[model samples]
Target: MKYQDSLQQASDKAAQVKLFLQRTNLAAHPINYAVSYEYISGYNSELCHIIEHKLLAKAPLDDFVMAELYIRFLAPANPQQEQLLQEASSMVSRMAAYSDVAAEQLDNYIQQLDSSMLQIKNLGADTPLLNIVNQLQHSTTEFRLSQQQMQQQLLLANQQSHQLRHELEQLKQQRLLDPLTGLYNRLAMQNQLDIWFSEQPGRRIAAIAVDLDHFSRFNLEYGNTIGDVILSKVARKVSSYVQNSGLPVRSGGEEFLILLPDVDLRSASEIAEQVRRGVEKLRFVSSRTKKTLPKVTISLGVSLYQQTENWYQFLGRTAEVLLLAKQRGRNQVANETMLAT
Candidate 1:
């Protein structure tokens, strides 16, 4: 404890000597740095104990701490320990080069350490070993400041990561949401459809294509503003029917695509009929109507997937059949038809 206190207040050399004083204490704790020292042939556990626990030893104790410390700084071969090799080597070299006896040998150790780095790319980027490097980069000549630099870098990295994640979440919201109706836009629709397709196939998948009969005249006569009102009403009314039904997407102006999972042709037709009846019965207020204006009506084309059909082909066939429903009359639901192969 006294030696640790002295080392805490002392210079790097004094701290290093204090480290030797606590050598045997180090043996009790796993050597965080021992693996690297072992690569170059050095372990000062018992010697460390002798220095720290000298009062407890039996006979004349051998001081392996200074010797192993010297070996740690001076040994030439280290292949496995790459992350701390440079900093550990540099710190050890600093200690050894000051010693008159090891000054010439320290140069050879550094040369070998430098050569080892050539085969390895920046491995330090992976571990939190930046503390040691940052210490050297920002440290005063006298103090070992690796741990301090590590703390500053850690906080900065965490803050940057949080900001980046927030930005990414916002971008994802923009990409996945429809700005006008607050529904999922087309891109998001396709993404979800793909995910659904990959998972359990929709128990009963039905695609219905709907077109507003005489919709063009509404835009032309009522003006785009009134037409927008009518469209919003239509979207809301259709969405209401989808309790557990698949999503309803605005495929295009005056047209919508409804995906109903686990619903077959007969059931899908019933749902479409419900939508038609709902729209037919509602009084649409348009063009200065003190009285309730004319009710809007829509034609729907429903298509059910056969075991072999994909969503793309199913949707295409549904649209074609929907055109047929328009030809018969604008206000009716067409029955499900098999996709022509």
Candidate 2:
């Protein structure tokens, strides 16, 4: 009876996903479908409520918006991340305390050596002098042992600190990655921008904003599973184009951001064009049906960073250029030069 009940529940969940997809005119893609199924199953009440309200208001369930919802609500928290942070903090505190104690011990050892040397100068040239020399030797031996022990402790502490720092960095990198496309997310982009600005104040920064053409229609026709495969492929292709010189980020659903440092608008536009062509050349075949999928294309907008403008304004200008590309016709590159005219 339990097994039968579980099967029934699965069926019901699938039904609900289908119903939601139909009611909202959302693509029956895996990500979208899974989100819908989870909402109907009451797995994430917050996501369900937000989606319900959006649907009631007749909002478009575009890939970008849906991806945001999935990430914000459905992505599971990494317990390991929290544990690593706590361990790293503890290690830092312990190391600081250890350094203080080591410094104090070294000072005491130095004072003992100095006092012993003075006693040697004041002692007579007989048995008392010899005894003083012997006592000094013993003191030196003890000090050496203590120093060795402290050195060992310091080595151990250093190793632990290095390991914890590395782990924390890994966690931080993981946190800044988009789960779906294996690309850096917006948070990482912000960090990278900050680093660039701090390190090279006058360095030229360029942005290429890319949007997949007719992506929603593709999802509607081929379903989301195929759409996901295409999205990953396109992301990889775009990354390949700028792998050596820039950073590729999954900026939103069906959208990507490529940041090029030390590149001007012309160079950036060329790179964007290369990415556009690369994506156009990609061919996806369904593993299940062994059929070729439709051709995919991307529109790109290129903009150079202005020294006086903030990062948001820089990105906003790039987005505007991208919108112009889409308006002019899809699968083209639009740059700030065109905007100037």
Candidate 3:
């Protein structure tokens, strides 16, 4: 259900998933299939990076390893577990720092003790005194050994803490994305916009508000299940145009907003037009009924950032332009320039 690929695309991924399972000699279990499918889809960057590193190192991709990856990357999040991991990571980091400082102080103490013992030996110390010094030295050595063992344990725990922190960060990112579309959700869009504004003052940004035409009607006719499939596919199609330079966001149930920085109004409108046509060309057929569904179309409104207005105002203006597009008729791109006309 998380997949947004068309029938052919899903079929192709299934083939690739099978090949991956065969090559790795992993059983075609559901967990293994899910991991491989997501990896091959290239949607989960964190999973792909870890798997690629393991492959490079010639590490075994056994069932345990695959299960761990699935749980870490794909499994549903547990808020309590997340909080516990965060607390554990912080505690381990603090303990590691304390141990390091303690180890340094212990080394200095050992050096001072050695110098005192030498001075005592040079100053004609008696056998009883020498024996006491030897005993102290022996105790110190034992303490140092224990400290070293603790340091080793702390070092391993520190490494594990770092891993947990990285996984926690990945989980946070996953939450920012729409589970069905894999596009940035509104929260993520707001965060990215804030970052962009802070990074470059008075920078030009373009927003394209894309709305599916009569989606509620479609949902009513096809039922929610089929509508979801269609929405996922259309969301994927809408995102394909943005690529690396822009943020594609699932702003509403059937609305998407693409944010492009440093882009002019004309270019953004053109991109919107391309998205419109590309989505128009997508063909969807109901797998259960074996009947072709109606073609899906989108209406988009494009606007550029205004130096005098805040981001919300800019987005509002863009949405208004999109509404104008819908008023004129659906399945088209409308830009801010047309607002005056």
Candidate 4:
């Protein structure tokens, strides 16, 4: 049954990829083919959704965008790579076990030889000295062989361990990244915050909470496909602002969060306003109809972390400020500074 299910999934994915390629009019180039395959496979849902949106809208998948998407999704592990990783891991485990057993046996043999020597010495050199010496020589040869084997195993294990660690780090990075906008995801955001807090308990961590203004209305007017394209573009714009000094996170849906460590509230708010203007200035046009999209805007809420506050409280306060921004008017930055005034 599992085999049958796997076969069905493969068939479906192949069909989807073929359809996508036809729709996009993409040539069967290696990069194009690989990108199409990944999209249909649904391994990277975010990437798939964005590409599907573009294809449906007949948007130009230019070299630059295609290259970015390929680098984001196709740069990670595939089945063949994963299988090889598993095999390498198994080999390392087996080698470690073999090394442990070999060392233990060698130690036991050394102890037995020591006992034999002690017995001989206690017996005033009359307790079958020839046999004891012969036994000792044989044990010494076996022990040397065991030591050589153990050393070889240790060398191989070290090499494999290094390779495995590299692969694992790549996997970790891939997992932490958001497939849609090529920004860090929520998990990565939290992990980064924890690291910053641990390093400096009183670090000035500021957050910007971003929400698309009337996203539902936009999606309704332009359809979900166009909506996704807008979201991706907006996220990219937002990410560009803080890429150098902070973490840009696609918190969820059409919302984003930017974490700026060692930044004051004023700096964070300025960054948030920059992101807002960047998003506001974007003009999207459908490649199919050449129809210009409605102007998009985002509401931003910025807040600084309080020493006495927890992460949730800090986040909630930012969220509250964002709500105020939306309530006051969209496409504006709201912060504690504004609230105090």
Top-scoring candidate (TM-score): 3
The digit string of per-residue lDDT tens for model 1 on 203-295 reads 567877777889888788768887777877887788788765488777665777778877878888898999988877777765575655456
Error of 3 at 168 (Å): 2.4
Ordered from best to worst lDDT, the candidate numbers read 3, 2, 4, 1
lDDT of 4 by residue, 1-341 (tens): 21233767878877887887787676767787778777666667878777665554443564445655676556656446767766766776666577667667766867787687667666676557867776887877787787777767776776676677667667768867878777787557767878888999888988999999999899997899888888998988988888566998877567888999898888888888888889989999998799998899999999898988666566767777888899897889999777766
Q: For every model shown, what is its TM-score relative to the native structure?
A: 0.48, 0.59, 0.60, 0.54
User: The CA-based lDDT of model 2 is what?
Assistant: 0.80
lDDT of each: 0.59, 0.80, 0.84, 0.77
lDDT for each residue of candidate 3 in 221-276, tens digit (9 for 90 to 100): 99999998998999999888996979999877788899999999988988999999
Clashes of each: 4, 2, 0, 0
TM-score of 3: 0.60
RMSD to the true structure for each prediction, in A, is: 35.4, 8.6, 17.9, 13.0
lDDT of model number 1: 0.59
User: Where does model 2 exceed 4 Å of error?
Assistant: 1-165
lDDT of 3 at 147: 72
Sort by TM-score, best first: what order?
3, 2, 4, 1
